[model samples]
Target: MTKNIEHQFSMLVREIRKEFVGNGPKEISTRFVGSWAVSEMKGNLTNIEKFMMGSKEGEKMVHEARTGLVKKIYSDLSVRRKFEDLAGAAILRIFSDIDIEADIAMTIFVFDRPLISKEK
Candidate 1:
């Protein structure tokens, strides 16, 4: 049941990125950790972004822009509601970061309560 929920969460995040950012990661894997959902995403770079990797400034720009944009996107009320519904908790914060050279991104969704039971 947890795996199913995680998979669904991953897919929803991937789609959200694709819809708002114009490109989505090729793969996303999610895990629940107390009140946090940590997701590692791969293949997030577009062809233009790959080209930008050739320069230090370009790489930094991409990294900053992607991280900032994602955080803002998730802050939307409707978007936050989707995640809250899935995790069964209100989201307190969101953290996003990306490695331009590695084409990988990490997102951490912080919830008001644990998504999984402690008794388990």
Candidate 2:
């Protein structure tokens, strides 16, 4: 299962990189961080058993994370300026292809409101 998930993640990276960089360089400097990175960071916080039991909720969470990370990559001004509008359009295209609830997906991707006060 881990291997399959890793493979899927790699495929996603390749797809996004192809859209963003074409065949120009092996690496391109961009502020758009990979969703896999976000997933890895947050996945540990998510309970696997709970996720399995709450399949619908789990799917929602996963979809939101995917959409949100993509949006962040596309919307970051520094990143967008470097990649041009193609990044934004590519993100939209990817999101459109996904069958998940569109409004919820978009909302999840939109920038979150900043905390008014820092937690101590």
Top lDDT hit: 1
For candidate 2, lDDT tens digit of each residue in 31-117? 223321211111112244235435787667766565565565556565534322322222222221123432211112111222122
Question: What's every prediction's RMSD, in angstroms?
Answer: 1.1, 17.0
Clashing pairs in 2: none
Tens-digit lDDT track of model 1 for 1-120: 998999999998998999998988998999999999999999998898778878889888888888889989997999999989888999999988898777889999999998888674
Model 2 clash tally? 0
lDDT of each: 0.90, 0.35
* CA lDDT, candidate 2, residue 72: 57
lDDT of 2: 0.35
lDDT comparing candidate 1 with the true structure: 0.90
Off by over 4 Å in 1: none
